[model samples]
Target: MQNKKNVTLLIIVAALGYFVDIYDLIVFNVVKKQSLQELGFTGDALKANEIFLFNLQMTGMLLGGLLWGIMGDKKGRVSVLFGSIFLYSLANILNAFVTDINQYAIMRFIAGIGLAGELGAGITLVAENMPKEKRGYGTMIIVTFGALGAVVAGMVGKTFGWQTTYIVGGGLGLTLLLMRAGAYESGMYQNLLHNSEIKRGNFFSLFKKWSLFLKYLACILIGLPIWFAIGVLINLSDRFALAHGLIEKIDIADSVMYAYLGLSVGDLASGLLSQYLKSRKKVIFVYLVLSVSLMFVYLFNTNVSVEYYKYMCFGIGFGTGYWALFVTIASEQFGTNIRSTVTNTVPNFVRGAVVPITLSFSSLSKTMGPINAAMWVGLCCLALAFLATLYIKDSFSKDLNYFEID
Candidate 1:
């Protein structure tokens, strides 16, 4: 009973940690234009700077993922959790006071570094500690609860103004730090820590073997469409609406709210369905197809009413609802020693894929226009994800109590 209590408490901490992570993650998308305009960026400068800041933040995550993932294995998941939250919480508070674009970018990059650690560390702890048969549900609860932070971001970003939104998000993270006090380390991680003979947290070792490299690459690939949709389709929906000749303007925050609302429902449904079906690949395959089909619908049609366009955003978000399952698969794929590294780096790499994705979109837009550029870029992402899904092994019933060798 006490063990179960500890597990429950750990899940609660992971869930709420992820909640703040998502809030800070999505809040920038919600307030990008308002905040940028307030800093005096107008016309093409606004669009260019938006991409710059967003990509810079993703770059921070790319680096931070490596930093925290290595630390999660070498030190412990609990320490990474505390350290990451503290760095990001302080950075977020500093974000409220930025008076120029450079300051804004610096704070965002710092906050990104801090934000990168939360989900991977939290998920690693939950996965290592939970029973194999029920870990999917555990991860599902964290992600579903966490995704709601985007909805709250939409509300708070709209109601509280951009500066207050940053303050509120940072405050929530600091408050959650108090609750992190009750969390315990993963038993698997703890056991691995005592065995100095076992190799752990070597990021370069993944590249030493062909099969290992491919598996790691496939894990990252299967998640590309998720970020592409959110990063391009939903985040830049306003520009798309203008290109489509739609009379009504799209509100960035509302689109994110509606889409994430679908994402929350989709995550819940996919989690239950994966358990019932007892296969991760099948659920992911289905969601990937649904997302791709909706992307075509979203791009091909110009007759959609503003309300209908928002519904389409919700549909696309629902279709890509395998976010938690994707991370869970990565967590289950490796040994306890390097599992945190794999889990952390895979998601952020996909997020960082947005750098190339948005860059490609921008370049292609100059020649073919934004709608067609998005369609082509999205198709490429979807195709890669589908093929990679076929290539990687299903980890649903795999044991994770082993170590990776050097």
Candidate 2:
């Protein structure tokens, strides 16, 4: 008999937490010019140097995920979520002050640990608390807010200079602190009296069941590589377009913003379709094939030419399908008891660990050409998503205790 207001507030706050983490993670590349120049890496090969920086920067997501996953499973998810938000938010505030590339890299790494933690912990909070009927829809709302945050950064950069962009990020991060202050721990979490074998908040008790860990291992290994490829494409796309003189800087910003909008739109559709569809497994099977199919058009073709609409279509198919189905559903795949163990797999480490993915895209762009390198990535990994989909099972609204027992 809880009121609707508190639950609504909790969801909103959690969404903001996710949004700002993505803001900091993405804004670096969005405003790459000033930051790179500020760092003092001056030469004909300055562009080459940027490739490494971007790769190093994005790896923070992995560190954050691993950090929060264990903490959320061990400690209270709410507390871990709070810590992740504070640390990463503060990191972005500090990011505005860095005078050099080395300092930015170090801060970004620290920010990443916090950033990754917030993502895993925040998603866990929403999934654990929301009702099953709205769970998939809830995932759409949260990630959509994150995409919106990226859109905000681009809009701000277009109007204001890049330096002020971090100031805005810092302000948003700080404002989120107010929103989170009122967030009460989930009532569901507070009630553990019904269970006998399990203690209310025992860290060691989670792993007392061994089979759960085995299942997690398979999901993590298969998922991380594909996420790595996706991240590479996103980080490189704007830079690739800018380098080729294919579009104006403003148009580049608009394209990225459009991608976010398209991604969020696709998410809404995925959520709606889930209710009418019986087999989420079957839905994902189609999504995987479509994602791979579109990757062919995305990688080999140009998003800048008269073919821009085709690229936009590719985004709708791939970006939306990735989070709406792959990442979003990953959190819901396992039971709440060990949800963190499994769902956090592809989000954090899947793309997080591969520092080389971004680097490879950058190198390929430098060596061959942006579109050609993209083709290589698409052809190499297009069918991989389908292969991974083969092993996936829907974990929708699982019975927590029963999932653990099985």
Candidate 3:
């Protein structure tokens, strides 16, 4: 029922969701130390707690993602996207008022729910609407805009305070709700409504399918562990940056800005990179290996000569190579009926399972040098990417039907 011109509006609304998603999450990572201290994490190694907090955020992302996936598939991606906007915005605003680490972590988990909702619904909306050849392009736009949100959060944190940053993120999330309400549902879903009976399925049937089951396993094996590290790092990076004085005294907004700028650059380049590579799996493969090696080198080479340079490289490479690339690959691997199902749920369960265990790993990293610990974790996770990449087929130039959920 919608024309190609409507596609323009789709990009704007969808990209706005992505933007808020990044804003909500990236601040935790960029200003981890300051936030932890503000909420009463004090010790010789306040930084260590960052890993646990990071786990909480990732866990939230995973859980939110799973629920959002099911809801989007059943209720319509637009409905879920709007739902995400409200949840994350309110949670962010509330996050500013929390007082203790326990409360902070709990609040973050709540916020993560909103974060999960937006990411799941927004991604599915873009993938469902875009032409097959350009799905990656649209996804890249979503990622880039979302990454830009991090930049905005970071800049705001640096200029004002983390609380102020959350206020902006909250306001942005609130403003978008009305915009999202005006958006349309999937053309595919509309067709289903007009020409077919609603064959309403329950939650259990959604996951019982063998295809979704295997994809869930893959998400656990390859996706969750790496994401565990990513979540921890994002929540804790301000401390790391300040460690070398590239950032001095964890000015929350500035640290966030540094991270956001890095991710935005990576999103743009990786989007182009994934488009040109003609093979998402292979590009992911190369970046996974390279990012690990680079993370290790960056960790030990603490020469003040290039402190900010190292932080910039780490943020950009992490965004371009490890973080955004895998999702693009996963989106195209599942068919339409189950694509949203796979994208949203698989990452969630995998993250949930991995987070607690990964917290132990983070503890070890915290005891060790943050960089050293990250390198060790990065290497292990990258190794998983290596194995998964071998099994993941290229989907860009292929027909969607060629790759079903399994």
List the candidates' TM-scores in order.
0.99, 0.83, 0.83
lDDT of 1 by residue, 105-186 (tens): 9999999899999999999999988999899999999999999999999999999889999999999999999999888888
> Pairs clashing in candidate 1?
none
Error of model 2, residue 201, in angstroms: 10
Model 2, position 90: C-alpha lDDT score: 78
* Residue 176 displacement in candidate 1 (angstroms): 0.3
Q: In candidate 2, which residue pairs clash?
A: 64-116, 64-117, 224-350
Q: Provide the overall lDDT of each model, using Cα atoms, as 2-decimal numbers.
A: 0.92, 0.61, 0.64
- Candidate 3: Cα lDDT at 93: 86
RMSD of 3: 3.8
Give model 1's TM-score versus the native structure: 0.99
CA shift at 59, candidate 3, in angstroms? 2.5
Which whole-number lDDT from 0 to 100 does residue 28 have in model 1? 89
The 10 consecutive residues of candidate 2 with the worst lDDT sum are 197-206
